[model samples]
Target: MCGIVTAIATNNVVPVLLEGLRKLEYRGYDSAGLAVLAGELTRLRSCGRVAELAALADARQLSAHIGIAHTRWATHGVPSERNAHPHISGGLAVVHNGIIENFESIKADLQGKGYVFESETDTEAIAHLVHYKLQANTDLFEAVRQATNELVGAYAIGVVAEADPFRVIVARRGSPLLLGIGEDGMYAASDTAALLQVTRKIVYLEDGDLAELRRDSYIVIRSDGSPVEREVHISSLSADAVELGKFRHYMQKEIFEQPQALAQTLELIAGGAGITPQHFGARAGEVFDGVRRVLVLACGTSYHAGLVARYWIESIAKLPVTVEIASEYRYRESVPDPDTLVVVISQSGETADTLAALKHAKALGMQRTLAICNVPESAIVRETALRFITRAGPEIGVASTKAFTTQLAAFALLTLALAKINGRLSAEDEERRLAALRHLPVAVQKVLELEPEIEQWAQRFAGKEHALFLGRGSHWPIAMEGALKLKEISYIHAEAYAAGELKHGPLALVDKDMPVIAVSPADELLEKLKSNLQEVRARGGELYVFADAGSEIPESEGVHILHMPEHYGMLSPVLHVIPLQLLSYHAALVKGTDVDKPRNLAKSVTVE
Candidate 1:
């Protein structure tokens, strides 16, 4: 979970590298540093945010036209100045994202060869490896190729050499990296946002691919160093994609845009001419035909999406589904037969844990793999046999909003496809469900109208130190996601519970000082949720709810209600989530927290 940016140009590159790091700090910010190919022997590295590091570098007068920068999320070592990236060895310095699983062995080998390491990071091993390789051969590209062949595990690496001065070598194994072709220079970044300020023309690095960047040009090659042709994909993302628009914060804009995002996603899945029910249904059916079990693997918000998917699969597909957090999934010894299908969900399609989990599942001889991702060309999408993309556009906010709704929409569609494949749903049932899915966008639009009320409610609850979110059935995961969003962006101590579980333990935490936000949509569990709300109210917990528009729940009783739009069974979670997102956004806004870039959290987890 770190960010890497490299620029190769004839002009000054330090400022460009710094600007790119600022845009990419959402990826990681525990520590930041840059290695520049200044004069013949100048390189600077410091710790902290890019601003602080840049100030230190300025004092050192390190300048260069070819450089690499990194914003690190501590994984292999403590967050410290020396552990920060752009690690140096001889005249070569490198910045890397992702973990090196075999670093200890490599470090021991290097130490036996009399190599001294200045940092405890796994990344320092690569710098020393390159330095060792270059001593035998001065060719930077050849050295990197030789050194990388000896390494194991996921990495997106960028390196610069003071000797070369004009070239940057970049490579990717199991992480995300992009090459941006600009008029002034060529760039390499871990994400598109970093290069958006320069150019929209980019070539995403495939696994085992390497790129050589120079001031005027760049070329792609395989791991073996043979020349390879590249396809340049123009990003459709506008500068506005990163803007807050009329909203107070990017989180707020994202919260309000949920309706449109959901609508667009529904249209893409249901109305897209190529996405026939037969295609998705037949594939899903064939995959799950005699499936003994299902495994859902994902990370962070996607893991919550998988939890909700488990509920859907078990209830509708009549198949048992196990949801595993990707980070923890591989460490376990449980194995699934070939009859099992593993579904991986991610928004960026490059989450390191999720990718590793997919690989682990494949290594276990499970061939049936499917991906639900937002980015169409992400690493997960390319590696999976089947893919479903969420049309959520670019979600720049560190804490996801639109991506969550779009993922839910994709999961709901997958449920229908599964039902159709298994013959569990009749034509009439399928049509009814499809009709409900079709209406979700409108329902989401209505929920977006609750923002003003939610903002006011956020004002009331802004000063509270802790809050609890409660829901039942499918809404349970929605409650969990809502709580996660609040705690992620606002730094609030928020917890989620199944409404029925409140009395079991969480009820003890309820008090007037702790506001309880309950998702009480009109469903079979509405009455049960209402009773749970009453229990919280009895315990002096202030109640705030987003309830169905015509629900029989009391509008008085000191309860603050934001009327929710009507939705059919199982679809209410998608609509009900909007207000909770808004509540968190506004609460963070009122608290004056950095809603977009929360502390100690990265937008994407690229390193384990």
Candidate 2:
């Protein structure tokens, strides 16, 4: 994933373009560049964050009425100035997101055509192709369209021409691109967040769609140059969605908002206003009742959510479940039979690997596919037969916090619904679980209140470069998720181990500087997890635990506890996750890392 922004206006547009790039910076930060048409060819590029590029552009006085900017997450080449975006060929410049699968073949052919390439990026090939085509056809739109026809695979392209300084052309394949119409100018960005300040009315470009924008007018067209009608949808996001408010980082703001996010999700599902488990309860039962097996495919934190779902489906729904990492699931030739039900979980609902896995399962004739996603209109939601939306609003942070908890809530609700349909649980049992589910928001809120203590503990472990997360049973996956978050944003090398597996091999990593974060919530495995914590402490590993309020934590040793409210067995994971999320947030804050936009990470992975 990468961020792209284009602006064409009659007046100065550099400020607007810079503001939009700042909004879209969450998408990528490996490098940043901008191309401006200021009566002459002018380009500003850098090998770091958007701030660096902005400083360089400011020094060069590169202001223009029409421009395109990009914040790159390097995929085709190494992160360097030579490999940055806004690759220019002759009088044409282009910025792109998403991979060009046939780029090597295209590059070889273009090289044979006597085209000199400046950088080893797939995007440079497109610039050369556009320049070559414009030699025969002077029209910029036609040249871009002809160039895109030769390219294969995913791309969201923004192009500007020195010959036509007042115009900008954009096209989309598999990645996202949006158009914002304004009074004096028009803006094109990868998401609404980038253009919200300029205009609230927007148009989302579908695959194979092209748009030509000018200072006074904007038009949408099909790939073949035929005019098409476009819908301008208004965004529901407010300014506060992007603001950190009182929190120091978006990760921490998002972590503290989990109580409300979970509540909103539960309300959406239980309120019956939109799609919910009740709508699919009977159909889900019918599908799973005759099904012999279940498959869960996801990536990153969503994958950990699936691991938690595996426990619920096996224990409550009484079904055999398998969790597969989406990236690996499609590469393997093992295909699910028609009788198996496949569940795909994603926060963005546009994760590349997960989408590929869904397609692979469908191609294998697996009919019953369900998507649990946060974005209601995401690509995966449209492709799946059934869908459940997790109402965790606008997760701006690159690392997930509320999305994980909401996915767990959705999985738990799905499990209960399946149990009711399969006759695995009686009406009383279903009601009891539903009641527990209703109280989860409050339980989660209680755990979130422990953030103060968790932050205090975070300071003590901030100097440590490595940590261990230990849990057993359902908490094992929660521990894994915690460790992953810590490593993702904090740059801390953390590992998760099943309490029993600690001494097997991972225990060797433990030392005085290694702090072990244990998920010892009050569950069936509480005693076993406590014993594991003791084992780590005996080895000079600092013990930081999230324990139940009434659990006996040994005071004789160096046991630091952030007590959580006692909740039902399955619901504890959702509550226990908040403290760990806060701990990671504070740790990353202490480390002075860019928590919202972590290095070499993007908010969405739209390209394969």
Candidate 3:
């Protein structure tokens, strides 16, 4: 994933471009650069973060009325100054997000046409192609549109030509792009958060849409060279929501924000009101009525959320559920039924693999689809007939915390809604579930109180190179999430398994050097989980168990116990993941690694 912020303002836009790039920093990047049209295409590049780029700009006194900035995550080349974005060719400068799949052929053709390349990047091909088009026509917008016609893959680009210094040309064809209507000028960025400071009014661009931005106005064109009108809606995001207030890092801030996040996500249900099918969307009743089976598709953490929902839907609604990794499912042959409801989960709602898989399923006649996502204006939410927007606010951390918990909360509501629609949930049971849902925020607050103890537990893991997590039944997914958190932030090699699978092969890897973390909830599988812990103990493996209150697990030699504040029954997974997240955060803190921007990872995966 990369970030793009372009502006054609009346005033010096160096500060605006830098601030926008800072806002988009959470999306993850290795290099930062900017090209400003100050009579000529002048660019400054850095091989580090936006801070370094800002410093370079300050040292050189870079300023302009129109500019394009990018935070590169390095898809096509190594992270270096030359590979950083704002790639220039002839008089055109371009910054891009997403991939150009057929860059080799295009690069070959351009090279034969005497186009010299400076960077080894697919985006360099775009700059050359645009410059080539500019030779035929002087209109920047027309040239960009004609050049994009030859591209074969996803892209959201911001291109500026020195000949047309007052305008910025932008196009979107798979990745996300939007235009910001500001008081003095026009802006374009990859996310709403990037433009929140300058303007709240946004116009989201669809695939194959090109736009030309000027100081006072803009124009939109379709791929077929026809003019199109795009509605400008007000963005609901606030600038303060993304600030790291009082917390040291965004990861810590997000972990502690879970209680309030759950409150906001469950606001409709937390008042003890009855749950209904309409909670999802206006057309949920029509879709759920004919759905005989459920297929959940997602990637990464969202995929793990789907795995947990598989248990909830099948056992509660009595409907068979299948969870598939979206990247794999899109390329494989799968049986699709007309009566099946396909649910795609994503925090950003623009996950490339998940969106492609949703289209793939729709192409196979699975027409009844729903998207559970956070962004209201995202492409996936717009593509689906129904959607449940998770109010987790802005999850700025690369490792998700509040977003994952809110997704689980959304799935719980979906499960109860479907069960009630099928006449399986009684009135009294529904009320009980609603009451439990209302109490989740308070319960999560109590779990957050265990952070000091979790920090102490994390101290033991500062020197650890590997970890094993265990859980039973629904908690198995929680265990998997915990392992993912640890490995994602701390760079530790971690894996999770169902408690029953220890004797098969994992038991052999257990020893004193490896720490085995277990989610010991007081569910039906507690007795069996205790036996599995004994298996670890017999193999001389140290234990770190997050047990329920009043559990019988003793804190002895190799066994360390951190009792949860409460037992949340069916919603225990949400509470159980809190301490694991804290564990990873503090462990990464002790190890002195980058907690917010983990290496080789992006917060939103916009490219395949």
Candidate 4:
């Protein structure tokens, strides 16, 4: 994923462009650049963070009435000044997000036409193609639209033509782009957070929609050049929501926000006596009635949420569920039934692979669809028939914390709703389930209190190069999520295995130097999990167990116990994952690693 911000204003837009880039840096930070049109196209590129780019801009006294800026997560080329965005060809400067699958053929054609290519980026090809289109049509909007017609694959591009200095042409297909209406100017960005300071009114562009932006006005048109009206939504997000008030990093702020996040996500049920299917959407009860099975499509942390959902849906709803990684599922042939409900999970709801997979499922005649997402205006939310918007607002960390727990909270409600609809849940059981959900925030708050203890454990983990995470049943996915968090932030080589699978092969790697972290909930599998922990101890592996309160597990020389407040039956995964996240966060701190913007990772995966 990359971030793009464009502004056409009466006053100098250099400051606006720079501020927007700073807000959007979580999307990508490999390099940053800006292109402004004063008398001609003035371009500045940097292979550094936005701060360095700002320094360069100040040194050069860059100022313009219209400009576009980008912070990139490199795709087609390595991170360098030459590979940064604002890829220029003749008079056209283009900044883009998403992949161009047919770039090789397009690049060859452009090269054959005697056009010189500067950077090894697909984005450079778009600039040349738009410049080429300008020769036939003098209008910049028409040139961008015509050039896009010849290109394939996903793109959200902002183009500024030297001839049309006051105007910016933007187009989107399979990537997020939106226009912000401001009193002084018109703004376009991949995310609303970028333009929050300038505007609160946003117009989300549809696929293949091309827009021409100028000071105080913007016009949106369809691919066929037909004019259309897009509704402008009043954004609830404030500039303060993105600020890191007193926290060292956004990750820490988000970790503490889980209590409020969960509370807001579960607000509809917190005061209710029982749960209902209508909590999902107006048409959810009808959609759930037709669902005979469920197929979950997601990627990354969202995929792990889907894996945990599998156990809930099958056990509570008595529905067969298959969780598939969206990236893999979209490219493979699979059985798709119209009666099957396809549930897609994403924090941004603009995840490229998950969105493609949703379209793929719909193409195969699966009409029943649902989205569990954080953003209310995201593409995945609009594409699905039903949706549950998690209240985990603006997760800036590349490694998710509040978003994951909120997804689990949303999934728990979905499971209860389905169970109630199918008669699997009795009235008494439903009340009990609802009670557990109502107290989820309090339970999560109790878990947050254990952070100090977990931080102490992190000291032991920080110096280690490798670790193992073990759990059984539904907690297996929790273990996997734990391993992912540790590896992602701390750069530790970590792996997770179902406790039952330990004897199969993984037990061989256990030693005194290796830390074995176990999720030991007091369920029926606790004894078996204890045996797995013993297998590690027998081989001199240091065991760090997060056990249920009142569990028989004893603390000894190598066996360390961190007791959870309570053993939540089905909702344990949500609570158990908190300490693991804390451990990873503290471990990353101990190692002095970047916790928010981890290496080679962006917060959003908007590209394939």
Candidate 5:
């Protein structure tokens, strides 16, 4: 994901634009740039961070009443100052997020027209096309609207021009864009946090909505040239909430925010009223009552949440659920049951593959859809028939910590709700699950107290090249997630097995040098998992185990153990994941890898 911001104010907007880019640093950090209208379009760019771009703008005294800025996660071009953002052409500049699928063809068309390109970015194609339209039409908003029609891809754009220095034009097709309305100015940003400092009055721009922002006001128009009035939503996030206060990085801050985030997610259901399909949406009760089966589509960490939910839904709700990676699900042929409830999970809710899979399912006649997402107004939420917003606030970390836990928490509620609908949830079961849900935040908090212990294990992990993770049943997904976190942030080669599969194949790879990290929570599979650990021990594999207090597993003969105060039963995965996040954070710190922004990884995967 990339960040785009622009502002039109009665006074110089450079400060607000720079601050907006800074707030959006979590979205991207590869390169940043800004273009302003000070009698003429002046563009300043830097290769490293928004601070560098701010310094460059300061050096040139870049002051303007109208400006556009961008922080880029390189997609079509290399990450460099020359290819940063605000691609300028013919006195007009454009900042764009999302891929341009037809850029090569558009580039050829622009090149054939003798329009010289400066930056090797697909964004430059939009600038040239806007310039081309500006030549035929002098109206800035009309030119932008016309240019958008010729493009074929997902995009959120902010355009500024020397010809019309008092106004900024903005539009979005797939990526997010919002308008901030204040007394003296108007603003456009890719994130609400960017505008939280300027104005709490936020307006989410829908797909195909084009807006023109002037100093005092703004106007939004539909693709068909119809005037549209967008609803203004008052935002609740504060600047302090997103800042890394008393924390080393955004990832670390987000890891600890799990307790608060999960509390917010569970607040509505903590009253003992029990979960109902209405928690998803108003029509959810009707849909849930009709569907005979469930099909879940997701990717990465969100997919792991679905994997864990498969165990909960089948056992507790007695429902048949099929979990599929969204990208894979869209390409293959499947039996599309109209009675199936298709559920899509995403932290950003704008994942391209997940959105496409939701659409693919809808096209195949599965209209009963649900979205488990963090963002309230995202593409998946807009497309799906029902949705449950996971209140994880904003996860800045590239490797998900709180979002995954919150998703699992949402799944727990979903499973109980489904059981209630199917007549499988007894009054006693409801009381027990709701009590567990109410106590889950405190349970997660207790888990966070183990960070120092996890850090010690991370120190040992930092020296290892390969690791093995083992678990069983619901905890197997936790093991997979732990392995994913280590590999994603720390660059560690880690593998997870169902623990029973160890003797079948992965046992041959076990050695003393490769530390085996086992998730040995007190569960029904504890005996089988312990037998698997003996096989690892006999083969000279060193083991680090996280076990319940009464599990009887101890630190003896090359095995290291961390004892949990108590077992959380069905909700153990939520508690077990915190230490793994701590492990990844400290391990990445030891290995000196970029913890928040890992190599070749963007916080949001907007493209397929």
Candidate 6:
């Protein structure tokens, strides 16, 4: 996924474009570029973060009242200045996101017309095509529309012209683009986060929509050339929430923000003694009543949260639950039930595969849908019938922390609501769980105090080449999440196996050099998990156990134990993941890897 920001304002837009790119850099950070129309088109591009490109613009004193910018996560080409966004041709500059599928044929046709390419990107082809279209028509917006007609894939494009210095043309097809209307300016960007500093009111452009932006106002047109109006919603995200105040990195800030995230997510039921489907949304009661089963779709860390929700849903709601990786869900042939509740979870609602899976489920006649997301006006949130916004704030780190825990909190609320509606949970039981939900913030805060001990364990883990994570029952998914966090940030080769499956085959890989991290909370599965640790020790494997305070797991010659302050029961996964997240962060910090922006990993996977 790449990010695009366009602004036409009373004041110079160079600072606005740079600030917008900085806010949206979490979406994509491989390269950054901008096209500003001063007396003529001034195109500047770079192969790194937004700050680098901003420095270049500053040195050159690039200034304009109208402009478009892009921070890219490269798709068709490598991260280089030539392959960066703001691809320019004669009299036109274009910045694009998503794939321009069939660009090779378009490139060949453009080359035959004596238009040579500058970069290896499919975007260069679109730039030349737009310039070619402008030759037949004098209108910039008309040329952008004609070029979009020639393209065959997804795009959110911003086009500016040197001849039409005060105008910007934006178009979107199957990608995210939104317009912000302000008294002094008009803006368009890939996300609302970039526009929050200037405007809170936004109009989200639908698929196959085009817009013409000028200094004072904007006009929207549908793909068929008819004038249209989109709804404008007020955003709740504050500019202060996205800022990293004193935290060293976004990962660390998000990890510590868990307590507040849980507190806010659970605030509606803090002192309540009951749960109902209305907790999710106004129409959740009607939707939950028709739901016969549950199907969850997610990717990456969100999928692990879905897995943990599976256990909660099946056991508490007395309904069968199925979890699938969103990417694989659409490719396979499977039976879809119209009565099933399709739950899609994503931190950024723009995740491409998850959105595709939601559409597939809807296409298969599943009308009951719910999106657990962080962004309010994203694609998945707009598409779903009901939604639960996690309110974890802007998660800038590639590795998710607060979003995962907040999703779990939301899923726990979902479980309680479903259980109460199905008569599986009595009013008293519901009240008890409600109280536990309210105390989740305190519980997680207690767990966060163990960071010093976890840092010690991280010192041992950072030097290891490979590691294993073990858990049983509900905690198995937590183990998987821990392993994922470790590998994602620290670059350590790690794997997770259910503790019961240790003897089957994984034991052979355990040796003195390999460290096995075990989740040994005081649940019913703890005894069996202890036996699994013994098997690891017998194989000359070093054991690292994250146990409850009095679980009787002692630190021995080959056994290293770090006890959690208390047992959290059903909510233990939320607390357990904190240390693992800290361990990964510290490990990466010690290893001198990029902690915030991990190599080859972006915050959101908006492309297929």
Taking all chains together, each candidate's TM-score versus the true structure is 0.92, 0.93, 0.99, 0.99, 0.98, 0.97
Instruction: Give the backbone clash total of model 4.
Output: 0
The CA lDDT at 205 in model 4 is: 97
Model 3 sits at a Cα RMSD from the real structure of 0.9
| Model 5: per-residue Cα lDDT at residue 102 | 96
Query: Which pairs, if any, clash in model 2?
Result: none
C-alpha positional error of residue 310 in candidate 2 after TM-score superposition, expressed in Å? 0.9
Higher-ranked by TM-score: 1 or 2:
2
Q: Write the per-residue lDDT of candidate 4 for residues 217-275, one digit (tens) a residue.
A: 89999999999999999999999999999999999999999999999999988667468
- Report the number of backbone clashes for model 5: 0
Worst 10 residues of 5 by lDDT: 268-277
For residues 316-384, write the lDDT of model 3, one tens digit per residue. Answer: 998999999999998887888999999999999889999999999999999899999989989999989
Model 2 residue 317 CA deviation (Å) reads: 1.6
Per-residue lDDT over 49-76 for candidate 6, one digit per residue giving the tens place of the 0 to 100 score? 8889989999998888999999888789
- Model 2: CA > 4 A from native: 59-63, 224-230, 269-291
lDDT score for residue 393 of model 2: 85
**Regions more than 4 Å wrong, model 5:** none
In model 6, what lDDT does residue 532 have?
Answer: 88
The TM-score that candidate 3 achieves is 0.99
Query: Candidate 6's error at 212, in angstroms?
Result: 1.1
CA deviation > 4 Å runs, candidate 1:
44-48, 53-63, 269-293
